[model samples]
Target: MTSFNSKKSLRRVSFISLSFLFISSLFIQGCKTGTKGIESGSNTTLEASINQGRNVFENSCAACHSFERDGIGPNLAGLTRHLSTEEIIDFISNPKKVIDSGNKRAVNLQKKYKSVMPSYSMLGKEKLASLVSFIHTYKDVPKPVDINEEGILEDPIPHQIEKSNFVVNLEFSFQIPASNEELPNTRITKLWGQPNTNEIYVCDINGKLYRVKNNKPEVYMDVQALMPNFKQRSGWATGFGSFAFHPDFENNGLLYTTHTEPIGTKNADYTLPEGLSGQLQWIVQEWKTDNPKGKTFKGSNRELFRIDMATQAHGMQNIDFNPTAQKGDKDYGKLYIGIGDGGAVQMKFPEVANGKHSPWGSILRIDPTGTNSANGMYGIPSDNPFVNITGEKVAKEVYANGFRNPHRFSWTNTGKMISANIGQHNIEAVYVIKPGANHGWPTREGTFGINTQESVRKIYKLTEEEMKDGVTYPTLEYDHDEGNAVCGGFVYTGSNIPSLTGMYIFGDILKGKLYYADESQMEAGRAIDFKEMRIALDGKETTLLEMTNNGHAKLRIGKDANGDIYLFSMNDGKVYQLVSEK
Candidate 1:
């Protein structure tokens, strides 16, 4: 119930309180041989296998992995130093074999990343060997970075989150078409029902917006087909990030969308000062359709703004309107956009994500129809927190600042804005954001103070002399041991599940596990205790991981006009409706 307040110096595997769940991967190095450099022992390094491996890596592995640094998957640069070619190939084919072995190092790897690297067993031995051969090229692992070796909690929240009294039962309701042929067959992000109608709309990262009728989806808008320069890389939330319909869609038929373009598609409005490399640009576009009720979109598009990022990996996640706002309310029709740091701080360019005006690490509120912004494309609300501030290029559109990745945001019944912020190294947080409040990123994670200069990966106790003031922390938080990423959910207003009414239900995007906090009990400056929500699949006891071929869940939440909730997997393109609560 305390106010917004409050790890170690280690490489990717910091022994801090953050809990990782994915089977610890690459425990391959802590073998009997110790940390000696390893060499591949197979003849599979032929040119063909290497090239095929490269292709497979781009299409499959690239989404969660890389050689230079850590990602959702472990950095592969030094992977060969611990395990031989055969061992790695075997692990990649069926990672669970080693994960299930209960190796201390292996389990810790799971706890560190809190994510499972999908097995490539379907590729068979030939492709698997090729992939390992390709990975073997990066033989030198970078030395671990452990900056401050003091005041770290091995387990952040030592006590287990209690299980809820309600068990949600899911029924298979519908499916979106496949966006790709690999691990995430579908790249759906949001599935929201149209206001005052039975119509439902969903969007995919590969650039398709679908309108569902009678449980069937038809293409509503195709951003990729419409824009030739549109780029969609597998990782880092590039391409068709999210979309929002104007509150007056029935009359205005105006829709807004966020997508990405290649690094140099054009000059960006939010460009880095200098010396920092610009990876890509996250864009916001406004579209107008002549017919709002039509199945196919017939519209014209206009670019609202483009933001340049230092690197990939957290550009834009979601853009939405205040659903609870009525037509005449001041909050009505104002768009809330979630903008991430774009890996700038971790890349050592803290300046890009340093302040509110930069717009890299903040939640922005704008009037889509107004024209008061510097760019003249949108309106900075007259009452935006930073609107009247003078000096140093102020981004007047910023409502609240300090978020690494404000992945999702939804309003509670009381008009409180709850945002789920995906963390770095440790802590996934849910915050009750207020205007101008800084949610401290680069300076803090959850309640722990982190030194960005020394090591972004390590944590230290919050010290007044060592930290800045005015940083707002999360009302609800969990370490990586519980889940890697937070997929936001809404405050259920539907009548189907009376128990869920007034409750905010959400889940882990990586683990497909469910969680919730009663919004009725939420109050100012109070720490909310959330519990794990149990689920049943189609009348049978099951988990989201069990419902998939791979161990990952790639989970996301959605809702119908009636306020009933829906669960869908990004891995398989299937959407499930909440049928009952027991």
Candidate 2:
């Protein structure tokens, strides 16, 4: 087990050896040194270049690179309109060289988007020029006048996340193995506990399943090695998404997992409508282990279903079997899948996830043991919210609808369901979920009206008529003033930290700031207050931001077998256990 501390000197290395290989490969490929092939003003050449460039961008760059909107990568729509092809090529060929020379644009881009700009040098001049040519055709649209400048909350929460009396002292546990040397070292999304089996599993989006023993991580399963078509490279949320062990895993060896594959790898159960392109497919699968008591996964796996996603931003996360449910309870053994809008609305396909009929933006409940679904691979719960809906083609598996990036959801002992949603440009939210609930997205963001047709960054106070439109608003929310993304956490019901009981702990993914709300006080139709919880490392005060290998903290919250919260920093691949005392 390795302890974590501030480490900046080592991490500043420029993309390490990967950038070197990218440059070396480009040098060997050889090309016109000064952008000779780019015919920026020729309409005839633009038409001819579109096919190759479009195909390349759609397949290779669509995962993170976008000309439309900025997420992980900067918007490239107006990229070439301001800069010359020579300057673009020079920067793409070597961003570090340009940045080192004090180019303000290159320096700013690096600081803003982090490692989203890996060396494009490996694409060589032909592909690079073609990619640039495709981007050049789409000029940036002129900005629209603010429709609701006065209505928007410049800082939604108004005040900073206040420090509470509670101090969450952490003890550093083992670091999850670095799957790759990329910026996000390990996409450690979930740390799940199976009570029956008394085992805790940590899932890395990079395809590894780790079983924690004492303070160390041991590989229990390797999805990348098992599934030939499995990939995490195409998107940040690609790879082994989430896993769920059967409530009776001690008696039954069943485990469910979600992963992503390149589009067209297999026919999908959920696909985009006519003319709209779906970039990737998310696969939900089940595995039955040969030995139920084994330390490693030796199993036979089968697919339950697959769905096409518009972009990789938000598709599937944190499948669950209600931990609080008993054997005879209605929720027992039923798997709940937190599905996002798949960037459909942001990708200009808003209608795809607009209602109950579409599975894109929904929380689905199903029985994995029975085969009654349309695909005959899984069973949709008969009592699900939409199963009996008439006069409409509804996805019966939908328990709730109208969420953009429904990252994680969990149930408390009081039977209240809570969820955290990743916002677009304005609010990061938490909602008390109920069946058939519409936690508004793409339209209403955290009690504010968002115009999907216009810039999503703009939000207006809801009109009187829009307020009564039956959309359930967020129970707790924060604006981008303090952080970037929300990493939903669980209500700490564990015994180790009695003071943390009923305190729903969560954090900002980008800023690594921690906050919590009184889960016991959270209720539907009513907003609750949340506050920042301070952190200490071995009796010394510290912030998760400073503890990361790089400054950026892709923070994820996890629960151990005892229900204790564990903090995962994808930046450093380290796991820190939150305790009442150091």
List lDDT for all candidates, in order: 0.75, 0.72
Candidate 1 lDDT by residue in tens digits, 1-582: 001100112122111011112212355546533323223344554666777866555444323444555444445566556665566666766767777888666666665555556675666677666665566666677544222235445566677788878788988888999988766789999998996678889999999999998899999999999988988876447889999999889999999999988877887777765456666788999999979888899989998888886555667998999878998888999999999888767755666666575688899999988887767888888888888887655777888888889998988666888898988777888888899888888788887877777656566667765445778878888887788788888888877777777888888887888888888776534578988988898677788888865667889999877778899988888999887888
* Residue-wise C-alpha lDDT for candidate 2, range 1-582, written one tens digit per residue: 011122222111001111211111122112334334466657887777766666555544323334455333434454544455665666667666756776444444443333323455556777666766766666673222222355445555567667777577898877889876555667788887767555678988888999987767899999988999996742257789999998887778899999988888988887777555666789889999999888899979999988887666678976988888889888889999988987667655667776677887888899999798888999988879888889967788888888888898887877788888888767889999888988887788888887777655567777778888898888889886677679898888787777778889889887788998898788875887888888899788889878883435779998866778889877667888888843
Deviation in angstroms for 172 in model 2? 0.8
Give the distance in Å from residue 28's predicted Cα in candidate 1 to where it truly belongs.
5.7
Misplaced by over 4 Å in model 2 are 1-65, 68-75, 84-153
Backbone steric clashes in candidate 1, count: 12
Measured by TM-score, the strongest candidate is 1
